[model samples]
Structures are given as C-alpha cells and as structure tokens.
Target: MAELTGRIALVTGGGRGIGRSVALSLASAGADVAVTARSPKELDETAAAIRALGRRAEAIVCDVSERTQVDAMVARVKTALGDPLILVNNAGIAASAKLTDTTDEMWDRMLRVNASGAFYCTRAVLPLMLAAKWGRIVNMASVAGRAGAPYIAAYTASKHALLGLTRAVAAEVASRGITVNAVCPGYVDTEMTDASAANIVKRTGRTEEDARKILEGFSPQGRLMTAPEVAAMTTYLCSDVARGINGQGIVLDGGALQS
Candidate 1:
C-alpha cells in the first residue's frame, strides 16, 4: 500500500534537483502533486513527470518570495488538487562570501528567497491544514543552518531562520494534527552545488575537480550527497510513520555535523 495514498502535496522549486526528486517520490507514494517554480517550463516538466507516475499534477508559476504570488499559487493548488496535505518548501538560493565582503543586496536576497519564501508558503497553506486537522510541512534546510560556514554567512543565516520557523510553526500546530520539520543536507549534488563549485573555482583559481573535492570531503563518507537521498528523507517525513518527528531538523549530511 502507498503511504501517501489520497494525499495532495505541494512542492515549491519542484522544477529540478532536490525539489524534482521529492515531487516524483511523493507521486510514486500515491499523492497527487502540485509543483511551483519561477520557470513555467520547468514546472511543466515536473508536472508531466508526476502525471507519468499515474497521479494528478498541476504546474503553477510562482516565486515563493513574493507574498502575492505565493497566495495565488496556493489558491490554484487548492482548486486543482484540493487542499495540499503535504507541503515541501524546497525553493532556495545560496552564495558564498566572507563576512566582511558580503554585500547588503546579497544578504537581503538570501533571506528573502530562502527564509521569507518558506514563511510565505507556510502561511498560505496552514489554514487549509488546520481545517483538515492534518498536514505535513518539510522545509529544505542545509547543514550550514546547523553549523556556521565561514564564506556563506548570509545563506547560513537564512537557513537558520528557516529552521527556527519550522520549530515555531510546528509547536503552534502540534495539537492541530500538523507537523512542521526541516531536512538539513550537506553538499548535495544539485545545480546549486554545481554553482558553488564553479564559484570556488573562480575565487580560488583551482581546478573544478579540486573545488568539487572540497565539497565532497565535507561528508565523512567522501562523496557528494545525492538529490534522491534528500528526497527520500522528505518523502518519509510526509508519511503517517513520521507523525512523532515534528519540530525537528533531520540532518542528511553523512554525519558531517553531529548536533
């Protein structure tokens, strides 16, 4: 039996990487999926993949950092797939800079996209969850959120804020049958990580392989984390078996940061 049978799930950034993996996994588990992203083309591709899995799917164009867009996206999802019982706040952006070199614009953008975006999406979906008396919210956080990284202060701070939001909202809805949690992965092999590697190469004048090695070495296992690995964790969190795991930040970093 599928764990998510009859569930409706909404995944932000569902166009690619971890978001795409999570959306497909949920559909495989029998949940109808609604996908949102800034790119309509990517959203359509993800929607098509979900439908290919024998599930209903809808694509919505949205930038989760914008409150109005978030609201409209949620409304569309509710109308198309019914109220989303599972929400994965998977949209985020990251950049690296020394604390003294981080620009005001970079700081603001990180917080706006990574933290505020999750806040807007969560706020938009909570009402429906409360009314139904059941919901699961999983924020895509990072190991940087748990531990400080020297060059990416803004990204780290935003992820930390996301974790804080997850805990606060989880507590508020604990009695309402809604669970809010976060998945913190370290150095996942995604487009974001690829960009980070390229950035490192540009900054340090190192070979791309060398820059990638730095990331892979972050995990004790000496390998980069895969999107499917993170998606699996997110998928489990949305299931009945994970009801007791609320208000937590589950780490999937190959035991990199033992907190």
Candidate 2:
C-alpha cells in the first residue's frame, strides 16, 4: 500500500462504480488523486472521499471523448498535483442493441467514449510519464471483449479495440519502465448492469432471479463481481511488485467462460 506514496494518479470516470472504487483505493494507499467525470457532483463526491482518506484530490470535469476537455484535464491535474505517474483509464460507455438495430450513432458513441477516450487521456499523460521513466496504466475492459455477448455489439467491439490498444501501447513503452494493461471484469452490480438486467427480465418475461442467473451463467461462480473486487486487481497491478506484468489483460470474471 505504501508503494504508491507520493505518486500522482489520475482516474477517469471516477464518479461511480469501479472507477470510484479505484480512486479511493489509490488515495488510501497514499497517492494524490485527480478524479474526472462528466458529472461534477460525482466527481466532487469522489474527491471528498479521497480527501477523507487524508490525500490530495482534484475533481476535474472532463469528457474523455472530447480531446479539448481531456487536454485541459491533464493540464489542470498537473497544475494542481503533479505529473501523473499512475493513470486508470476507467471511463467507458455501453449501449445494448442487436447488430441490425445498432445505429451508427450508438457505434460512434461507444468508439468515442470507450476506445478513443482512453487513447486521448493516455496520450495526454505520456509526456510526463516518459520524463519520469516510470508509470502504471490500467484500462477497464470487460468480459464481453473476450467473449462476445448479444445485444451489445458496440460495447463489445469497443472493448475489443481497447484491449488491442492496451497491448500495443504496453509493447511500445515496455522498455521505458511503463506498464500498460487491462482488467476485464465480468458482470458487476453497477447501474449499467442493473439496467441491462431489468431489460432482460422485461424482454424475456422471466423472474428477476432467473434473469440474474442467466447473466451468472457466464461465470463459474454464478454471481456478479463487486466493484471493490475489480479495484483490488487494479491496485495490485499498479503496485511496484507488478512491474513486469505488462500488456496483460487480467480477467475479473470469477471464472466466467473460463478461458
């Protein structure tokens, strides 16, 4: 935990869910945190939690999909804290639609927010990390990226592309003491999943328990993973002991689809 003491970290989409948990974890471990989200309220709440842990926190309003805002966010974080050495590319979007029903707007939005967004933020922070010669980047991916799911073509494809980007970047900077990796989680009890589950129950006319079990069928544990559980894996990946683990996509599936 003390390994991150004095480090500057940036977490995108830190308003809630796994992103929020990751931000708190970093702050608890002694890192200064910069939290970015479209919603200022969520960002403020995250910042408050970080400060409660006795660490510096910056609540930056940023839409990672927007290059201008992302750039400004980087500058603000650096100005307020320092050059971020740890980055959690946790911002992502999800839309559920079949292949034929998936509109171009949905596809574009997913690519922009889930894929391009990660690229923009990471690119913005690279200079400082390169100068320091040490960094940790953890991208939030999903099991859908590894195992395709129905009614979420855009989200699945975006995550698939994100994993590719994560691997490619990890290779390019592996020699420079920078680690870029992805953590792919299975179904988590987040608002997004709750909505998806509700839709499943409505569409299939099944009991809530049955609908949940259907989702659980993807995991051997037959349950959804927790946000803190996913955060733990990410926190460990950012640790000094995990310096050699690069270009790896660690699955947080609870044995989902057991590859």
Candidate 3:
C-alpha cells in the first residue's frame, strides 16, 4: 500500500520551489493535497501536477503572512479535502543585506512572511489535527536558522524565529499524536537561489556560475541541494515510520554542519 494512503495534506508556498516539490511528493505518496500560494497560475500548475498523480487536489491563492487569508484558506481546504492530516509550512521570503544596511521594512517583511506566516498556518491547522489526534507539521526553515550568514541578517533572524516556533509547538503537542519539526536546507537549487545568484552577479560582476558556486560552497557536496531531496525528507516526516521523530530539526545541507 502507498505509505500516505488516505492522508490529506496542505502545503503553503505551494506555487513553486520547495513547496511545489513537497506538494507533489505528498500527492505521489497517496495524500490528497491542497496547495496554497499567492500566484494563481503557479498554484494551478501545482494542483494539476498533484491531480495527475491520481490524488485529489485543490489550489488556493493565499498570502500566508495574512492571518485572515490563512484562516480562509484552511476553511477552504477543510471543505474540499476534509481537515488536512499534514501541514507543511513552506511559505517564505528571503532578502540579502548587511545588518547595518537592512531597512526596517526588510526586517519586517522577512519576519512577517518567513516566521509569522508559518505560525499563522500552524495555528489555523492545529484544531483539525487536535480533533483527529494525528497530524504532521513540517516547517520549511533554512540553514541560516541554525547558523548565522553574512549579509543576510534579516533572513537569518527570521529563520531562527521559525525554529524557535517549531520547537515550542512541538513541545506543546508532544503528548498528542502530532509531530512538529523543521527541515533546514542550505543553498537549494530553486528559483530563490537563482535570484540570489542574479543579485550577486549584479553586485560583483561575477559570472552566474561563479556566483552559484559561492552558494553551493556551503554544502560539503559542492553542489546546491535539489528540491526533490528536501521533499523526500518532508514526505518521510509525514509517514507512519517517522511517528517516533518529533520536535526535531533535520538538516539537509550535505554535511555542511558536522556537529
């Protein structure tokens, strides 16, 4: 039997990057999936991909940073696929800037989208999971959450706050059949990384490949991590075999942080 047979999952930031990959992974594992993001077109594409995998799918246009929008999106999911058994808080944004140059708006945007967005989605889904007594919550954090990075203080701070949120909620729900965890990846090969590379090119006149290699250098493998690699870890966390794993932050940086 498929590992996730009969499960219902909701993935925010599902329009692209890691969220889209995780949504497809969950659907392929037999979970009816609901994908939410701000882009209608991208959401449709992800939903169609999920449906092609033979699982029921829905696409919701949502900005997770907004509480009302999140609440509404959850309500819609409940109506379409019943309460989601798995929630992947994948909606986030990243900005690169030195601490001294970081504007208040930049800091707020990072915290609001990357940290508070996860919190809102988790809050909206908790009731459904509690009622059912079995749930999986995966927060899409970053390596910056665990360690500081140069010139991206705002982004790093937001991820740190996300990890704190993950740990605290995991503790609160430990006794329940719910597991809350974070998946931290370093320099994933996604649109976000491409944008970062472009920014580097504009700033330093380096070739795109060189800028990309700079990011990939963070991983011991000397390559940027793939979206599917991150998705596999996420799907595992939602499976029955991972029931024992709770309140943990699993790093997928190809041994970058050997602690």
Predictions in order: lDDT: 0.93, 0.91, 0.93
Following a full C-alpha superposition, what root-mean-square deviation does model 2 have from the true structure?
1.1
- Model 2: ten consecutive residues of lowest lDDT: 250-259
lDDT of 2 by residue, 3-68 (tens): 699999999999999999999998888899999999999999999999999999999988899999
* Candidate 1 lDDT by residue in tens digits, 1-259: 2399999999999999999999999999999999999998898999999999999999999988899999999999989989998999999998888899999999999999999999999999899899999999999999877989788899999999999999999999999998999999999899999999999899899999999999899999999999998888999999989899999999998987887
In model 1, which runs have C-alpha deviations exceeding 4 angstroms? none
What are the C-alpha RMSDs, in order, of all predicted structures? 1.0, 1.1, 1.1
- Minimum summed lDDT over a 10-residue window in model 1 is located at 1-10
The full ranking of all candidates by lDDT, starting with the best, is 1, 3, 2
What's each prediction's TM-score?
0.98, 0.97, 0.98
Error of 1 at 214 (Å): 1.2
Cα deviation of 230 in candidate 2 (Å)?
Answer: 0.6
Candidate 3 lDDT, tens digit per residue, 1-259? Answer: 2299899999999999999999999999999999999999999999999999999999999998899999999999999998997999999998898789999999999999999999999999998889999999999998899999799999999999999999999999988899999999988999999999999999999999999989888788999999999999999999989989888888999999755
